[model samples]
Target: MAMLDVKNTKLYISYGIVGCGNMSQAFFGRLFKDNKNKQRRVIMTYTPSNTRAHELADSIGGTSVKNLKYLNHTEVICLCFKPQQLKRFLTDAREIDFSGKTIVSILAGVDLKTLKEYFPNSPIIRLMPSMPVENGQGISLISHTDDVSKKVLDELELLSSKHSMVIKLEEKLFDKLTLVTSSGPAFVYYLFASFAKSLEEAGIRKDNSKEIIHKLFLGALSMIKNDKRDVEDLIADVCSFKGVTAAGIEELGRQNVSESILGAIDKGVERSRELQSEVRSDLPNLQ
Candidate 1:
């Protein structure tokens, strides 16, 4: 592996991403496209099947390696594989020397403790990025082990902040917040789809309804950003007393929509914990 060169006193961070899934493509694709400083680069991309690896690597102008041995050449290794695949991946790469390298994991429900058990000598950083990163609008939750160096942490922050709003969080809070930052996009999309469907049923053209709902969300978000008023105040401004919007709001409250949303989040959090337990059971030796 070639060591990082000193260029203007700044160290270049090379990443070896292990999976070529949608989330990986969304985050890394935007990062490579918008990066102008040339301080960060994708060294290699590896997957169980070489096809997706080749595709992603070609798109980013990085190498596509068929073997885990090539990962040793990279400075930071980003584990983008599914949490359930951790055991298989670790078993396959058991011989690779991850000792001085930084491991950036985006495997949901896989905690730092589990990762450290697999790669005891490596510094692990857990990152959970939302699906909106594909559009260059995302919220990423990050946490790291104590052994990670300040330089690596700063570089990761800069790299991630290019396509997402980075927030530091305690490792224990990761699963709970993953429901919000990671899974929230799908929930929002579901809500929009419901609204669009209602519009379509109310005599609007399907395409027009979808577009109107899209623009509605965009405008509402813009208002939230530009308006200084509280969210409740903004909602109040939208709803006149006993008006159409107020009627709908009253019905939603009557149906306990807020409680339903909270209940959904609770279910997701419980599933995350179940996944962690399943992973531990699968790899009992690591427990």
Candidate 2:
């Protein structure tokens, strides 16, 4: 399996991308660059309307075209389109024969059952990925139908897991996991920004305050990722014997900020749930 090889997956005029968006760029740009994975040739062309997608082709050893005509019957395809645009793209793409192709999708809110409707015969997969694939900083949860080729799944896991964390999950579970990982980064960044803003309001030197906060976060995350300790244990380590960190945390709790953040995360999870239904179309604009 390509995942096990890690260093090399065969390159081919195979593996097509239906939409070349931010998430696609992040994942491929990270995976294909692994010196070992470079052996695999993946030739992909973007749909015509995505004018800006060409910038990624050369980097991924792919191509840019005006339509889906470049797709072959035996190719592997990844769908990176917006939820609102999913129907139209699938409608136009239906004319193509996807007999031997495997379809992987990153469209949020939509389920595998809905995706199967478009490419019923093809092996269908649903994946939830974060935008950090650009830097290989996050994880993607994947769910595929029973009939999917093990070889294709292995190749994909090799590419995807290298750059982003991979979790082989059930289709129904991604709705919530998408909220945890898909939207979690932005939420964490928002919290950091809020703290920065508060420090600024307190008349701290902007540069010094920003650096302090940024490093505090970066260092904390580094520990969490490397230490293998539970987050609560880490917090306990920092808040030793009524330390300043503990006092600050107490103040935050008194102000109800933690409750607010919990509420916000809840809203984020619910919004992700709403996204799967066609009735929630136009969500990007809903904001």
Candidate with best TM-score = 1
Candidate 1 deviation (Cα RMSD)? 4.2
The segments of candidate 1 whose C-alpha lies over 4 angstroms from its true place after superposition are 1-9, 34-42, 284-287
Candidate 1 lowest-lDDT run of ten? 1-10
For 220-287, candidate 1 gives per-residue lDDT tens digits of 99999999999889999999988999999999999999999999999999999899899888874854
C-alpha lDDT of candidate 2 relative to the true structure: 0.74
Number of the top lDDT candidate? 1
Which 10-residue window of candidate 2 scores lowest in summed lDDT?
Answer: 278-287
Local distance difference test, each candidate: 0.85, 0.74
TM-score of each: 0.92, 0.83
